[model samples]
Target: MRKTAIIVGELKSRYSVGRALQQNERTGYI
Candidate 1:
């Protein structure tokens, strides 16, 4: 269970970083 939680957390953190980068690109385009 603990390992599963860690894996999920890592995936979420990576997703958030990618999302933030996309948003930054959008802002720059605007």
Candidate 2:
């Protein structure tokens, strides 16, 4: 259970970072 929680947290952080990067790129290009 603890390992699963850690994995979930890592995934959430990674997703947020990826989304932010994508938005930044779009804003810069457009």
Candidate 3:
């Protein structure tokens, strides 16, 4: 149960980072 929770948290964090990066690229950051 604890492991599953950790994995979910990590996945969410990574997803948010990816989304932010995509947005930045759209705005000409990348």
Candidate 4:
């Protein structure tokens, strides 16, 4: 259970980062 939670957390963080990067690209921030 703990391992599953950790994996999920990691995935969520990575997804959020990817989304933020996309937004930045759209706005020419990166």
Q: Can you tell me which runs of candidate 2 are displaced by over 4 Å? A: none
Please give, for residues 1-30, the per-residue lDDT of candidate 4 as tens digits.
999999999999999999999999999998
Candidate 2: minimum summed lDDT over ten consecutive residues — where? 21-30
Instruction: Report the candidate with higher lDDT, 1 versus 4.
Output: 4
Candidate rank order under TM-score: 4, 3, 2, 1
lDDT for residue 26 in candidate 3, whole number 0-100 = 94
Alpha-carbon runs more than 4 Å astray in model 4? none
What digit string (tens of lDDT, one per residue) describes model 1 on residues 1-30? 999999999999999999999999989953
Predictions in order: lDDT: 0.94, 0.94, 0.98, 0.98
Pairs clashing in candidate 1? none
Question: 1-30 in candidate 2: lDDT tens per residue?
Answer: 999999999999999999999998989953
Q: Which stretches of candidate 1 lie over 4 Å from their true place?
A: none
| Model 4 clashes, total count | 0
lDDT of 4: 0.98
Query: What lDDT score goes with residue 10 in model 4?
Result: 100
What's model 2's lDDT at 9?
A: 100
**Which candidate number maximizes TM-score?**
4
Model 4 compared with the native: what TM-score? 0.93
